[model samples]
Target: MDKFEQRLDQAARAAWLSYVGGRTQDEIASQLGVSRPGVQRLLALARQEGLVKVRIDHPIATCMMLSQQIGERFGLDFCDVVPVDTGTADSSYQYLAVAGAERLERYIERSAPLTLSLGSGRTVRAMVEALSRLDRPQHRFVSLVGNVARDGSSNRYDGIMVLADKTGGERFLLPAPVVAGSVEEKEAMLGQRLFHAVTDVALKAEAAFIGVGRIDRQAPLFQDHFINEGELDELLAMQAVGELLGWPMTQDGDVIDCSITRRVTSLPLELLRDQQLVALAGGREKAPAILAALRGGWLKGLVTDETAARFILDAES
Candidate 1:
């Protein structure tokens, strides 16, 4: 073989042994009958001459790129895009739960006390469940949504209690139904001293994690029986696309001024907007809702999957 060909072959072998075979420089040198420095030079030559190629086998690399693109496009401070699990029919919740738990861990691990607000939904519940148990009694958790439904049953997806249990932190839950019977009832409930006290603490939270719900027949509000069929139809007729913390909004992310909104007992969206609200939602069915929230600037951060992220970016484009 020619001198050039011999050098190239040696470099390729060294590169393969060092990178692909995970061999140390000393080990590679011994195998190739060269000094450790000579092995290093061969590896460097392989890289410089394009004889070695590196590729990440995991999907997180792609997800990170998508996260950056989405963050830049929406002017968000934080964004997490989880890999799409194509094998499963619906893996949005699975991946989002793990990613959301990791995100929450960052705040809970801090030693200083922090007040975190929470919104209820299957996604949020899943996230709480996925979180590892930690003793963070210095922190506090407050629910941004009421714990009760219209039928007097507890909201199944409410996660504040679970979060409190997991973290050993204090808990504050709104002592009213998700939606009151009437505006007068809502006003009376809101005026109560206990409710006022809870909201005061909620308003001062450092950050909040919420879930986005699409407004439709299958909306969480409708499915959970928080809102009746008539209310759902009204929201649909009003061009509502999504909801955050039970406040329905149009495609532009403007909260709809409907009777249902007036009866919603949760903290006002206007107030929540002033806080650092990060939404955890994904799935193709929720892309439009997620887009609306993004466009409306309702979220400072978002944790979603690549499928939904692509849809949101495409819709914005």
Candidate 2:
């Protein structure tokens, strides 16, 4: 072989020994009958010539670039982007939840007395359960929104319950409807001493987990009757596009002042906006809402899947 071909061949063997065979440079040098310094030079050449190219297909590394881009573009502090199977029925929600769980694990590992303001939803529930090996007895998880239905019903997937079950932390749940039937009822609930305790805990939370909610008629909150149809119509009429927790937000990420706002028992956005807020959402349909929240600077972090990240980038571009 020519000198170039011989060098390439030598580089390849050195790389194979060091990488796949997990051999030390000295070991490779002895086996290849070359000096250790010669093995190092060959390894460098392998890398330079792309002969030892190694591409990891892990979700963490793959999403890192996208995460950085989104974080910079939206002025966020942190972002966890995950690879997702867009063809799945849940629209990559499982992957998003897993990613959120991993991020949450990191936050929980920090020195205790950690207070978390949690939003109620299926995604948040999944995230709490996916968080394994966490036992923060000193930390606490408080609900940001009420889980009770207007008709004396309640959400079984309430995040407070799921979080409490997973962690040995204190759980403070606001036992009221997400939206009371009237402003008076909402005020009454908010005025209650029990309600203040939970809301206070949430307001002072060091971190918060929220879900981006779409305004489309297809939203679960609408279909489940948690929010009345007329309120949905009002949101649409007011040019509202989505919601952060239970508060309606415009496409520009501005919270709308509607009757829903007057009646929602959810913690005020003011309390959670500047906290270490991370929104867990995915699916192409939720991209717009997520972007709106990010634009409004309502979140410091985000946990989402690859398809949703791409969708946001595509929309921005």
Residue-by-residue lDDT tens digits, candidate 1, 1-317: 59978998999999888888998999999999999999989988887665654433465787889899999988898999887877774655867887888888898999899999999888888788777778999999999889887767775446998899878999998888888988999989988999999999999998999999999878988998888899999999999999998889998988899989989988887887778899999888898899999888889999999889989877777
Query: CA lDDT of 28 in candidate 1?
Result: 95
Give residue 230's lDDT in candidate 2 (0 to 100). 84
Question: Which regions of candidate 1 deviate over 4 angstroms?
Answer: 1-59, 155-157
User: What is the lDDT, from 0 to 100, of the residue 188 in candidate 1?
Assistant: 98
Q: Can you give the TM-score per candidate against the true fold?
A: 0.79, 0.78
Q: Which pairs clash (backbone N, Cα, C closer than 3 Å) in model 1? A: none
Please name the candidate that would achieve the greatest lDDT relative to the true structure: 1
RMSD of each: 13.9, 13.6
For all candidates in order, the CA lDDT equals 0.87, 0.82
lDDT by residue for model 2 (29-102), tens: 99999999999999998876545434334747768989989989988888888777747647467666767877
Those runs of model 2 whose alpha carbons end farther than 4 Å from true positions after fitting are 1-62, 154-157
